[model samples]
Target chain A: MKILLCTDGSSYTARALDLGVRVARKAASAVDILVVAKRDREEKARQMAEKAAADLETAGIPVAIHRRSGQMTEEVVLQAQAASYDLVIIGGRERRGVMRLLLGSPALRVTEHVPASVLVVKGQARDLKQVLVCSSGGPTSERTVRFAGRLARALGASVILLHVMSQLPLTKSAVLDDLEASAEELIRRGSPEGVHLGRMLDLLATEGRTGHAVIRRGLVRDEILAESREGQYDLIVIGAHITPGLNARLVEDLSAAILLTANRPVLVVR
Target chain B: MRRRQGKRLNWRKPGLALSGFLLFTLALGLMKGGAGGLTPLLRNHLEVTNAADSMGFGWLMAYLVLSGSPVAAAAVALLSASVLSYLQAFTMIAGSRLGACLVVLLIGCIYILRGHEHWTALTAGILSLLLTGSIQLAALPMGLLILGRGWLDGLSIPALEGLAAGINWGLEPLIGPLAAFLPGWALFVAGVGLVTLSFRLFDRALPQMRLERTDLGQIPRLVYRPEVMFLMGLAITLLTMSVSISVGILVPLSARGYMRRENIIPYILGANISTLADTLIAAALLGDPRAVTVVVTHIVCAAIISLLLILLAYRPYERAISNALAWIARRRNNFALFLGVIFVIPVVLILL
Candidate 1:
């Protein structure tokens, strides 16, 4: 896997660089560090990129560094789109004022716009261990599950697939015997959610890893965050919003919400 | 063969729709004629002299009928009769919406009685009430500001005058005899019943809520953007002309595992704004331009507040709602406290 690590010479980006190096070393992935600076800050940008690259090289990971002078988010997005990197890692910053209220921080914008999967490093940096893969059971989640399985296999981490059952039939008269069933029971009955869970587990098994499926019924994002908190997972993996067409903005992007709110690192797969 | 074909093509929906329209028109006429009688009761007995009191009155009235649109229509009739001021009418309509969410709660209670998990059965209703209560209440100050500035005061629809005149032409003969025989208060009581009946007929005319799980297969099982859900809520309510019906469908959708708490918030927000379609029609029927403006104020304020919440502070707002849900679900006492507070606040408003 090829990984792109983004930096801006900040302490936050330094933490992301360190986390990126560890991840690349564990997964045996090649790394490229891209640092974007303001028009006159090219020297600082080059220094940050080289430092991040040297850290990766010292870990015995194949590393390359690139420096660009432009808008940080635009530059990072351009590089990610240009390359065939499987993942783009960046550090999240606490935004304030109009930026926090209207547009999110540059890191968040890049995460939302980038084509590759984004791993937004926030809060305390930690090694990949317990992984929480949030599955909406949509077709796109198959890719998220497979990608998470591969990442887990590389990191030798335990995997937990969480499916939140938040929908209820509109009327009481409709038979809800199946809805009341547990995840285990649903799997036994071959219910759609159950079958989806079974298929995801099988995919993980193909990656030479075993994963447990857990079901929670509540708000989708809340349940995912709650499960991540309860399990103390090192990384939370979710699928990018796949609301195609003009009405795409009408759909909530759960991955973006997770990135904005989750205290730990979040890996959003496209 | 022609007769058989005629019998085969269903006319029940169209027939019910015509009946509902006639009933709605009749209800509007009755309420307008009798609204003056409500003034004394409203001022002396209910003591709904202030905007807050009128809002409380509307809220309690919705609780009495288990719906809000009728209460909102009542506000318009009262406004037309000079019984309630424009601001009072606006707040009353807002309060009716707060009370309207109870219908969803009642549906959730039925689910619980039928042996569904407490949170699973109640989440849609709880979130519906929460979203409606929060967004409407937050919009109240802004609505008041808009009214104060007289922003929509001059807003008028000249086309409605012809419609109102046509309605008068059709209903004058029926109302004249009733006006002579019935007391004003009695006419108002009868009007309320007719309005409720009209709503029932309209609901019957609506497409049946018999959606199969397979029918929703194309709808992705993901959290929709608040704006998308908001528009959906608006569109559905506009079609059904009842927030209760729109939110009621959400319960079944949620029960079927096709909706989430996050998806329903904006949906409920949009539903609340458009649920006033009946009230808006009532305003037009009364030929009171200001009545139309009052309802328009609520709609405009609500749309602005909902959009701002979705765009700017959605994460924090969502977190707050989720935390409130957790608190309610954490203990039986918490739920009881919530229910008690919702009931008590309206009474307090009336007393104030």
Candidate 2:
């Protein structure tokens, strides 16, 4: 897999690079580092990209660095689309006002527009023990859940599947029953084949009463944010695919909303 | 202590009162001008009977509904407007019943403010409905006369007919040689330009005329319950539909007004008005319509829905209805589910 790391030469970018290197090492994927600079600052951007690329290469992670000019967010998105990279990793900036507006936060715009999944890293690295997957029982969500289950297993984390049953005039008893049936199906489908599967099923049957399912009702984004805040999970996995330009804008807008609101680091896996 | 209290009182904010006055003045001016300009245009080309014209009052009611929740307002408005067109085929009295209920509920709301020293304002709303209703009833004779004379041209007709005769009979003979010299295309361009200019001017000059911000801070404390919101949305849509249907059936004579060529304008206007129900319901259920800017958003969305509907006609609404129904199907067991499956399915299957 080709992993794209979007950098702006900030300290956050450096940390995100470190995290990307670690993730690439684990996933056995190649890292493609992309730096977007102002049109006039081509030399500066090239220098930063080169240094980061050399450092990652030295750390035993294969690196391919690319630099371009223009509005940072738009350029990065265009590059990601052009390259067709599997995933885009970017640093979350803490800048405010004009500087922040001009550079355009990569984490904000890329998450929304990019067809590939995005990983927005913030602050220090910690063990990812609990993975929460938001599911709507759609194909996109099923894919997300499967990916999350693998990541949880790798990290020795227990998976918590949450389904936000929006209170849309359904009786409480009916909604609860639907949630239970869905939870059972998810657990059954998510388990691997063979000896591991039997043990997983036994574990689920026992803890399924407590650890497995969570159902909340409200707006989609709000409910997701609320669950994250309450759970304080280390990473959030979301799905994405390359969308048309106009649809990208709509997704871009939604991504910006999530970034501004969500507290935890989001690992968007395609 | 008394002197200090007096000084503190003197320092109390002054700008709020000033701003309020300015906003009220601006709102009044826009309302007057908009009513004046659109009324004449609607009358001339559409030739809706006066009773049907009173349906415009429903527009004001819709504006109230939307003022509270624009997003939901826009959705409801789009659905209601599209449904209204079909409902008109049944009977004008049925349509009038639907239209009148909306108007009455909205106009009736003003009465709630009667005890708050705004009794006169409430009275004005009641009086406006009465006056408008009377005028519309009175205009029936004039509409009949025009129809009898074959002057009532439907939307399917072209704007121009017998240009040479019009120039000779209606222009040159009536207004003399100056009318013939007037560039018709230039005049049309100028008229469009003037309308655009007025709209811009009104938008710029009017302050309070702007959409009221949903007070979101109160959402958490109020009806954040999803069930409540769903019910409220359902109730408002049903009530609006029922009222529109009844008006169409009961006031058979007012059919043309409900189905005028320029019906899109009121339909668009009603889109904003219908949202007020959601906001009001939100306020009642949740006690805060703030977190859910559904109404405000819907109002903004109405412009998009209106443009699309005007351009695409039934196609856009059909897609929206289907999409909404599909969403309901996925979520399953909701009110929309029962309505879509139980109500729509049986009816459609029986018809098929």
Candidate 3:
């Protein structure tokens, strides 16, 4: 497998670099460190790439370093599309009003168009400990599940599946019964989500990965963040959902929101 | 969702399916024409002294074939031919809808017997029948009153009338021979068969429901928004032209384990509304402008009740339906008894 690491040279970028090195060494993947800068800083960018590459190679991992002077998003998209790189790793930065709008993070857009798996490291995690695979019960989560499984197997870590249900119709506890019916009619019934969860559990079993699932009936992002922080997970694995139709904007926004709010490393598998 | 392209047929042109639709329309038109000759014989056998009796006949008719559209179409055709009163036809169509929903529940019965979870398999089918039956039954009284007042005469679609006209005239070469040679009942049967065949072909022509993209892979989540699922159901039914196919698609998807019981009702509500399109074709073929009026009446009545449910009490409605189905599916005895009761009531309605 070949992996590309795109960085803007920040502390978070260093953390991403470390994670990338560890993954490449463990999985025997070839690594490329790419630094994109405007023409004036092109030479500086080359020095940064070569230095990062030297450190990775000294750790006994194969490495290639390249520096390009162009737009960051365009360069990575072109490179990722032009080649069948197994995974692309990028570090996310906290952006304010104008920077966020004009430069509007490339990771969000890249996940939308690119077919390759992406891992966006949000925080500094030296090693993989506990992993959280966020699921919306959609098909795109298949890649996330498998990727998490491989990492867990490789690192001997545990996996947790987190599902959040949104209560928009009525209060989650509310039920409608006939006002006129006798007491004999009132028997307790629960939602049939168990059958669906059974299937999801089967998906994990088929992958030869054992996992425990936690369900929360609340806002999707809030619940996921709460689980990640409470679990003190080292990494969060979620699908880079390019949601279809009207669901696209909402899902993409949620993905971005989760990426920004998460205090731990986030791996967005496509 | 990226529409996964198929290997063979360009769903783009759909030339063959379009031809199948034309023939299907022609078949329905022929059925209308043939039904005209069988009016006396049908009136002799299917005639009922009261509305309840006619409804029972409708139930029996739909039960015979496990489809509601043809039976509803037949009722409208009989109305156009003056073989049955508007009240009789309205009640009968309601009964046919009630009976049509049986197909899903019946399929669920097989699932239960095969050891699948009752809540997963039967909920969709039961909710489909219950929703359609309640709305249509509720719509019947107002429908009869509206028919008596003749309020819908101005509401006819000139374009639809013309389309029906063009079809009948164009297909005379084919229909005339069959009409001349075949007995009336046979032609009616043949028309029903062709209508079913047309629907089957149309289903073949639809974009396959890729279960992988359905998102049920992660959770059997219900669409909390009733309006969205309602429109989705309407759109899917319009495309398939069969309520069973619209609802049946959920079965295989649910078997893969992701559809919620709450999602079933509104989808059935939408499907039940558009499932009347084929009946409208049957009514149009009769050439009585009033027959088209009757078809519209069916559409309006259903749409009104459905929209009313969606706007006013959709949540409670979904909860009640879900709770009731769960109660019924909770035990083998309850399942058997409910099955016996549903079957016995329609038979008793006919006997009464």
Candidate 4:
């Protein structure tokens, strides 16, 4: 696997490098260290790329450095798209006040526009141990499950497949039939959500990993955050919320919320 | 072959559209001609003395008919005959909407009686009614203010006069014979029947929509966002010209586990605002420019209140509604108590 690691010489970026190195070494992946800076900050950007590259090299991973000067998110997106990299890892700053609400961070913007999967390293980088994969059982869910399964296998982490049933029944029969039914009951009945979860489990097994399927009922983002905190997962995996066509940007992205609110690293599958 | 199929005109659509339009115009002419005859019944027997009484009257009338547009149209007809003040007309229109939202609930009740779970069957309808009720009640003061100030009295559509005249000319032949035999009040009743029939025809004119699970799976989750759902409700109501049709779609979707309660509140909010489109046509048909302004006031006030709810307090409002739904569904008596309160409010208002 080929991975692109972007940095800007900040302490946050340094942590991102640490996580990137660990992931590259686990997957036997080659790393391309990227530094994007303003026109006047070329020297600083090059220095940061070299430092990240030197660290990756010492870890016995093949590494190359690429330095570019332009708008940070645009440049990162271009670099990710220019090559067929499997994943792009970047550092996410802890935004506060209005910044948190606006969510204009370069890390998030790259996740939205970039062509490949993104692993946004926020807060402290830690050893990969447990991974939480959020599945909506929608059409794009298979890709998310498969990607997270592969990541878990590579990192030797335990996988928890979490499906949040946020749907409220419109009829009384539905409540009596399914809404209040627990995950085990749903699986027994072979309900759609259950079947989807079963399929996800099968995918994980194919990736040489056994995953635990857990279901919770509530708001999607809130439940995912609750599970991540309670489970103490090292990484939160979610699908890239890409809506096709002209009104693509009009829809809300749940991954964006999980990325902003989750305390640990988040991997957005594209 | 695919391009050819796409280009097919499906003449049935235009045919139905023309039939619906003709029925609507004929219904309006009949109602206008018969409206003057109902003043005695409205004044002495019904005693619709004030705005509140008329509001209750409209509300109760909608309950009897299982629809709101006809009641709203009747309010405009009364206003055209000078039997109701503009404020009365506005409040009556508002009241019709509050009562109209219950049609979905009633549909849910039928499902419940068929051996479905009571709570799930009724929650969507209950939520829809609650959302509509809150926004309409909040819009009341502002709507009354707008009509009371006479700010929109001069807001006339010049084309309405010409349009009404042409329709009157076309409809006179069929209406003349009925007018000769029927008393004024009876003519009004017949006109209302015609109005109801016209709406049914219009409903038939709309394209049939069925949301399969496969289609829903492809829909992005963001489509459930408050703003997007708001626009969807608005657009669908605008097309269907009936809140009953728009909100009614929620029942089957939710029952099948295709839609969520969280996603529907904003949709109901949006549906409430544009559901006034049919009443606006009724006002224009009345040919009293002030009648149009009356309906417009209700529409504008509803739009503002709904927008505020969506913008300022959507998350909180959604939570509050969810809580209310749970509370109502916790026991059978609570739901019964809710029904009793809703039923009694209109009676009390009419008495007031």
Specify the highest-lDDT model's number: 1
RMSD of 4: 4.9
Q: List residue ranges in candidate 2 displaced over 4 A.
A: A36-60, A69-71, A92-105, A123-127, A149-158, A170-211, A241-256, B1-352
Q: What is the interface RMSD of candidate 3, in Å?
A: 11.0
- Residue A29 alpha-carbon offset, candidate 1, angstroms: 6.5
- lDDT of each residue in B1-352, candidate 3, tens digit only: 2445653457543965887668677777667667767766655664465677778888878878888887887787667666667777778888888889787677766665766443445655666766776787689887887887988874455676788788778888998898899987788888878876776667777776754365432223433346766887798788778887775555544333334444556767888899888777667656677777777887898999899999888757765665566577677788778778778877777666
Off by over 4 Å in 3: A1-270, B1-8, B11-13, B113-120, B209-219, B248-255
lDDT at residue B351 of model 3 (Cα atoms): 68
Model 3 TM-score relative to the real fold: 0.56
Deviation in angstroms for B135 in model 1? 3.2
Best-to-worst DockQ order:
1, 4, 3, 2
Interface RMSD values, listed in order for every candidate: 3.9, 19.9, 11.0, 4.0
TM per candidate: 0.84, 0.39, 0.56, 0.81
Model 4: share of native contacts present? Answer: 0.47
Candidate 1 residue-wise lDDT at B37: 84
Residue-level lDDT of model 2, residues A192-263, one tens digit each, is: 111233333344344331236655544445667778778887776655433445333222222344565566
**Model 1 over residues A1-270: C-alpha lDDT tens digits?**
899988877778878878887888777569888877665656665777787677777878888778776777888899988888899988846786877878767767787778889888888879989999988888788899999999899999999999997664445554455556787887888988899999999988988889889998767878888998999999999988766675465566677778777989999898
Candidate 3: the clashing residue pairs are A137-B218, A137-B219, B220-B258
The CAPRI category of model 3 is incorrect
Cα displacement (Å) at residue A241, model 4: 3.0
Q: Can you write out model 4's per-residue Cα lDDT over A75-168, one digit (the tens) per residue? A: 7899998887889998846667677668666767888878899999986679879999998876678899898888889989999999886665
